[model samples]
Target: MRILRCLKRTPGIGIFSHNKSLIQLKAYIDSDWATCPKTRKSITGFSVYLGESLISWKSKKQQTISRSSSEVEYRALPATTCEIQWITYLLHYLHIQHQQPALLYCDNQVAIQIAHNQVFHE
Candidate 1:
């Protein structure tokens, strides 16, 4: 079975008052390649949050073997986007003010194209 992992705990705070406002939250996502010894496929994952609170995260293996690193990263986009949408919905439910368009970062160009163009990779 493929596994999806997400980091939930907030970081960067050693000791702070609850009354203090959190200015920002940073999420770092990576994969575990050691688990699948046979396939050696990297396990991809992502995280989402709002101001010092972890709202969402996910880590999972690729459904199919990717020919190259770009393909693996491209496959991870949909999953990441789904998490982002979920976090956005949660923010809306909590009535947190935010900008109209949310900014997403990706190192892969193919993955970005896949998210923007529906006809891509079809």
Candidate 2:
């Protein structure tokens, strides 16, 4: 309602890139474990940037209660990864060439280790 009206009237809000030839994808993800006292479910949030402009973002509560902070952070990774993958695929479909790998940033060290550990995959 009011938010839509504001957006319609807003200026300089759309994605603008000075250099379209060099587009990069980057993501940041985080989660807060058991932030809701009633449900005890964690909240996962992520933002995706295309070069200097933000293209996608999400913030939602986890479907299940996470036992640990690491678990909650781990849960957030898949969602962000999926989003980055989707964007990559979309770029490919649009015939846009972004050769470099997408970078994902997360604050949880334990979760990062778990993601990197080969043993966890088996």
Candidate 3:
């Protein structure tokens, strides 16, 4: 596509570190609850950062409509987690070892709590 060609011509965003010290990978995930007025679907977004450098990010509308804000945020997490996992694997294959236990940040406190709980709720 035209946009892809334009992107290929442009320089990519990157950071150069002189020391090349070990840095932890962190991801922040969020969702816009019912952002689509017509479809009533949530928009999920997440950005992964290695220290201060931006690594990966994506924003897309969900296929299924979420009933609550908590549900919307929760739905966004799995994709973000998968992305981080893939990145981690790639780093390992490249002989790069990062800090253990990558941190994931989410805005919704209720969703975070619910994710940790084992009790099922309807």
Candidate 4:
């Protein structure tokens, strides 16, 4: 199985304070299959942030093989979108005003098209 190196951060490591409130966030999701001796299925992983602060992270094996890189990325979208929606709602519920239509950055054009086109899934 071919593995793709999806580095979450730049090479330099740094320390951060934990007591501060998180303001901004970023996320990265990727997959790897090279080390697994059994099923040989790739694993998907993600890292999340709060402002400049690291908040949450995850890594897991995919339930099945993705047909392409775009497919793998597509599979990751709903999960990320749900997280964004939850965060947005939380901010709103707390009376924190945020700019509308929160920005989501994705590299897959097909995934972006699918997100904008309601009929694609049908």
Candidate 5:
């Protein structure tokens, strides 16, 4: 109740906060590997943004177990990718154009290596 009251007083990000003209969509993804002790499944979370505007975000527990933190982080990538694609499609339908490829931000080095094809296996 106290937290809710505090949240109510704070204003959310407006449609156009810092950049008003155009918003280049990007995303950030993270996961807590083996967060659930019983199932050993991870908790995946992602946030989607249009330039500086936060358009969407969610966090949920995954159903599958992962052997490594990188594996769990890798699993989170596809969901984030799907979100980026969907947002891109919506932008296109709205006739908005952005030159940059959707940027993905993450922390796991092994997952980044795999994404760049720098390493075959962990």
Candidate 6:
């Protein structure tokens, strides 16, 4: 496969490093509106990191169709939040102190506004 060939050609490297002093969690999320031609479902993708090291990530087709791009991006929040929550609990179990709250970054402005507003919008 092309991926395997690229990996073989590239030199081995160690990039991730542990930093006990700063144990902050962050998640980046995005979604494509109506990417699937057949299902017409948006694909949600997210990556979770701990102190600059990637710890978790996923990309999958949404179970339900989203009418708007903002809706699609909004749907991604729960999954990313759940993953971050699980990681936080895991860190707590291991007695790793994470004082700062996890940050989520999304590209869509409407999605951000939707998340901020408490009132429901159809």
Instruction: Output the better candidate (2/4) by lDDT.
Output: 2
Candidate 6 has a TM-score of 0.82
Query: What's the TM-score of every candidate structure?
Result: 0.61, 0.84, 0.82, 0.57, 0.79, 0.82
Q: Tens digits of per-residue lDDT for model 4 on 1-122?
A: 00012223533443353655445556766655433568655666666554665545667777876666667666777777677667666657768564435445667687677778777562
Model 2 per-residue lDDT tens digits across residues 1-122: 23235557885573477775359899999899999999999999999887877778899999998889999998899999998998898779869788789999999999999999878542
Candidates by TM-score, descending order: 2, 6, 3, 5, 1, 4
For TM-score, candidate 1 versus 4, the one ahead is 1
**Model 4: pairs clashing at backbone N, Cα or C within 3 Å:** 24-51
Superposed Cα deviation of residue 39, candidate 4 (Å): 2.0
Per-residue lDDT of candidate 1, residues 62-110 (tens digit): 6676666666776676677666676666657868656645545667776
- Give residue 103's lDDT in candidate 1 (0 to 100): 45
- What is the per-residue lDDT of model 5 for residues 15-120, given as tens digits with 9 covering 90 to 100? 4557554567889999999998788889999999888877778899987889999999998988899988988887798697898888999899988878878545
Q: Can you give the lDDT of residue 70 in candidate 1? A: 65
- Runs of candidate 2 with Cα error greater than 4 angstroms are 1-14
User: Residue 90 error for model 6, in Å?
Assistant: 0.5
TM-score winner = 2
RMSD of 5: 6.3
Candidate 3 per-residue C-alpha lDDT over 22-100 given as tens digits, one digit per residue, 9 for 90 to 100: 4778999989999998999999999987666677889999999989999999888889999889888877886977766
RMSD of each candidate relative to the true structure: 6.7, 4.4, 4.1, 9.5, 6.3, 6.1
For candidate 6, write residues 1-122 as lDDT tens digits: 23235546875843355655368998999999999999899999999888877778899999999889989999999899998898888789869787899999999999899999999877
Clashing pairs for predicted structure model 5, backbone only: none
Task: In angstroms, give how far residue 116 of model 1 lies from its true place.
Answer: 4.9
List the pairs of residues colliding in candidate 6: none
Q: Model 1, residue 62: displacement in angstroms?
A: 1.9
lDDT of 5 at 106: 89
